[model samples]
Target: MKARTESDSVSAVAALADSSRRGVYEYILEADGPVSRDDVAGALGMVRGTAAFHLDRLAREELLTVSYRRLTGRSGPGSGRPTKLYAPAVREVSVSLPQRHYDLAAELLAAAVENSHRTGTPVEESLRRVAAEAGNSIGKDADSLEQALEKYGFKPETEEDGSIVLQNCPFHRLSQRHTATICGLNLDLLSAVTGKTGPEGCTAVLDPAPGRCCVRILPPDRD
Candidate 1:
């Protein structure tokens, strides 16, 4: 499956916002396997047409996957046309108001722990290394530091001094509880991102302030 963007997630959540569509989706989810429109309509007390409409809408939004199968065992000649079945899509849809990325943090921390155990390196060192590597991957495709930061929900704001302040932290909750470790990881990640994508000699540094991310990006000429 292709990677789902934030827009895809938003669309999927919106598709489920309708009470009828959500009911149809829930019914299909509880089914033992892919379900036909008739099955959904019977189970949910909905008309077949209503069920079909919801199913097709969900499928169009990529919330549900579609397949075709003949419910009855029969030869190709006389068997009726294959029934369209709906199943939950493999993709996960998540939408946070401020746009948290705990999954990304989990992935980075899990990899760091595994690497630490394997190579006997300190967990902190492993975390920094993995975070930087992840940042490098994110930065590679970005045209500029602000673009990359914005893409990942950092909410970068440029100051008149040519510095960038992150207006929002994507890992806000995690950082609140585990300030030191998460902030260090954030710094390493953004520093590497700056190295790859920021202006010449620009750097990311930890400069914690209320209501903003701990990391700030400074232009090369800044003192």
Candidate 2:
């Protein structure tokens, strides 16, 4: 999920990198509603085909939504084909190097804290339990532990020593400010998901390192 979201951000950024496309996007944004290719070209003094190419590109990246409408207000064959219109799509895109997921952590922490306060449960305990439940819910439909982790953008990588290292932390931003709390939440989430997969000889433990998540999943012990 995180990988895909990141990829989408990259694609969106690239699509708008062109000055012409960027101009077209801005024009549509400022318009009252959906704008057609002709409208964009006429307003921007761009060639109709050039405007169309950019509009199509934007639509492909989901930056814009495409619809068709008739300007003549006539609904018969003589009314002519409906003009293709471009409108802004509801999307949020953010790109960060090394991938950070502070928002996810903040949301979980906020919910846990609020619920804990209301129920009079200890914060740490409530956080751990809630994190576990969240992981469990994510893993419930997954075919395996790795799949579950990948789906949530953990970016797990296996070491030669039979340990799995998380290459990215979705809660990195939150972890920076509240290291202990966020790390604990990460551990619980991974542990719960791993537990659901029932992978033998594996356990999640804190093993902080630069450029990676703090928790590592170790293999079962040898005799």
Top-scoring candidate (TM-score): 1
Task: Give the TM-scores of the predictions, in the order they appear.
Answer: 0.95, 0.83
lDDT of each: 0.92, 0.85
Worst 10 residues of 2 by lDDT: 1-10
Worst 10 residues of 1 by lDDT: 1-10
Stretches > 4 Å off in candidate 2: 1-4, 117-123, 141-143, 147-155
List model 1 lDDT by residue over 21-133, tens digit each.
Answer: 99888887888999998999898888999989999999998889999988887758889998898899877889997878899999999999999999999999999999999
TM-score of structure candidate 2: 0.83
- Tens digits of lDDT, candidate 2, 1-223: 3335667888899988899999999999999999998899999999999999999999988889999888899998788998899999987667776666666677778879997999999888988888898878777878988887776677998989888899988787777888998899999988888777747767888999998899899888822
- The best candidate by lDDT is 1
